[model samples]
Target: MTAEIRLFPCLTDNFGYLIHDPATKATASIDAPEAGPIIQALEREGWTLTDILITHHHGDHVGGVAELKQKYKCRVVAPHDKAAKIANVDLRAAQGDVIKVGGLLARVLETPGHTLDHVSYVFDSEKALFAADTLFSIGCGRVFEGTYPMMWDSLLKLRVLPDDFKLYCGHEYTASNIKFALTVEPDNAALKARAEEVTRLRSENKPTIPTLLGDEKKANVFLRADEPSVAASVRMKGQSAADVFGELRERKNKS
Candidate 1:
């Protein structure tokens, strides 16, 4: 059976997700940005909180963990990296680990870049990827604790996923990300179309998430850093893809 997913806004731009398995009635919060919205969503959906799958140690991501755990007595799963120091973790997962939330299974992928202990969860059967912080709709998280090359490597991990996989990211930065993306590939037809779509979505106050990996591969310049066209756009024709990606990231930082 397919899992039921709920998306809601939390703490300004952060997006909170609830993945529920109908067969087992097991529900897991992807990350707890805050307890209020998650609690409200649980109440609205009539689903008991069974687990919390944390992606990183960021405050906005883990801020609600304590309260939610106290309320529901649910399992809290976090990265195995002791350095992350996330509180109330019941299970610590590493790369290639498979976490079972009732009948649904999520494979763990170590995708550090925005932070040293960052990870992303992939529900292969569901074609869903919860890539908090590391990957966004049209952009990626900043290389705060890792090297640019390391960040590029992390992006590559997610990039290799099936094209049909649906990406559920951490924040609502698509509008801004698209604006910056246009500077790198103004002539890209797919990007231009996506820009228009993003404009319409934001105008309607709708979420631009659950984007297909295929669409991102075609329009997101960050994901296309290895492409010859992307290299030419940044005037780094012969440079390695990692260097080109670094240049693109630097430009995004200043944008």
Candidate 2:
């Protein structure tokens, strides 16, 4: 059977996920911002925290790591390159590493863009991605530490996944992002439709994560590196795909 996944939103827009396997009584937390909400969700669901998976080292992402670790004594997993950034790490690996949560397994993806230590956890078995901040609902994370090319390459790795894969990202920034998407892809019927949907979501105060990858490919302006419209929008005086991606990212940052 598939794992039971519960999302508990913490901080302003950050999400902490609980992946539970009823058979083995194993549970894993994708990220921890503050321990209180995580503990609350676990208690509400009657699940023990068996492991903690860290996606990055940003304070908003890892603020409660020490407290959670102390409380659950859970095994902590993180990217090998982020050792200097993350506080504690019981296990570490580069991209393409797998960490099993009972019957389910999550593949490690080194998605450095939001931060040099950033990563996104992929579970092809279940078609879910704990895309910390690199990939959001309609928007992507701001470039904090990694180069634009590095971030674009990281997102490209994820773009090839199955179209229907459930994209569970870290924040809820769909409405505004899609609105900005239209500014760049004005003639795109799919993008306009998505913008309307996202606007409705925000108006209703609804959740906007776990968005579809196929949909992102159609609506996410950043992922459309080859699209003439996006390419034109990204074109500086004159540049390449990497430069275009960076330009698009900067435009999104202001939007």
Candidate 3:
């Protein structure tokens, strides 16, 4: 049987996802930053929560875990490294570990950057990536706990996935991110088009989740690692790849 995914936006921009397997009628929540929203959404969808796939121990990512666990009696699958902080860890898994929710299987990806203990949950059957803070819609996560290279490598790993893969990032920063991209490379046609489109989408009070990897590659300045324009912009500062990437990221932060 096929699986269905539902997106629940919560707390300004954070997104909590529900992956439901029709085969077994099981549902898993991808990072429960808040219980109220998750609980409400699950109730609306007529789904029962069976598990919580924690990406990291960030408060915004795990704040509602205790309440949700108590309410749903759901299994908490946290990364092996963040077990101590994730709260009520039912299963501790490493990178490449496979976890199940009914007929749906999620492959763990060690994507440390936003946090030292961050991980991503990938469902191969659906080509869906719950990248958390590792990779955003039109931007990458800031380097908080990891260095440029570590984040870069993590992003590269994500970049290799299928072009049509659905990227369910942790936040909705696309509008601001696209604004920053324009400041970085004003001449990028794709970036210009995407920014206009994002403006329209935001105006309609719609969600801009699940951005395709190909669109990010073409429009996202952070993902255009090998483009001549980005390289030239980076080289103008007489810096290394890491330095340039870091600078661009810093610029985005300030923008």
Candidate 4:
């Protein structure tokens, strides 16, 4: 059976997701940005929270974990790094670890760049990727704890996923991300089209989560660092893809 998913707003710009396994009636929250919205979403969906999958140690990402765990007694799966200090973790997962929410299985991918403890969850069978904070629709997370090269390597890991996988990132940064992306790839037709789409979506107050990986690969310049065109846009032509990626990130940081 296919899993049921819900997307709702959390905090100012963060998103909260609930993935439900219909066969087993197990529901896992991708992250607990806030308890109120998650609880409200669960109540509306009529699904009990069975698991909480944390992607990183950022306060906005984990602020409600403790409350949700205490209320539902749900299992919390977080990154294995002890330095993160997230509370109420039942399992600490690293890369290659497979976590099961009833019949649905998710493979853990260590994608540290924004923070050293960051990770992403990929449900291969369902073609769903929960890449909180690591990747956005048209951009990537800022490298906070890890080096630029490390961040680029982590992005490459996610770039290899099948194009059909649906990416559910952590924020509603698509509009701004697109603006910054256009500066780097001004002549990119795919990006221009995506920018218009994003503009329309935001104008109507619609969420742009769950973008297909294929579409992102076409428009997201962060994922196109290796392309000769992208390299030339920043006057880094013939340089390594990693270096081009770093330049793009630096430009975004300042944008």
TM-scores of the candidates are: 0.99, 0.94, 0.95, 0.99
* Maximum-lDDT candidate: 1
lDDT of 2 by residue, 66-107 (tens): 998999998888778744578768988678888987777889
Model 4: per-residue Cα lDDT at residue 95: 98
Global CA lDDT of candidate 2, please? 0.83
Query: RMSD, each candidate, Å?
Result: 0.6, 1.6, 1.6, 0.7
Q: Residue by residue across 134-252, what tens digits does model 4's lDDT show?
A: 99999899999998888899889999999999999999999999999988888889899989888888999999888999999999999999999999889998999989999999999
Report the lDDT tens digits of candidate 3 across residue range 1-255: 678999979887899899999889899999998999999989998999999999988888888899999998999998888434767889987788999999899999988877888889889989899999988877988889888878877887888888888899999999888877887789899888888888888899888887888887788888775566786775644455566677777777777
Rank the models by TM-score, top first. Answer: 1, 4, 3, 2
lDDT: the better of candidates 2 and 4: 4
State residue 23's C-alpha deviation in candidate 2, in Å: 1.9
| Model 3 Cα shift for residue 116 (angstroms) | 0.9
- Encode model 1's per-residue lDDT on 147-166: one tens digit a residue: 88999999999999999999
Better of 2 and 4 by TM-score: 4
**lDDT rank, highest first?**
1, 4, 3, 2
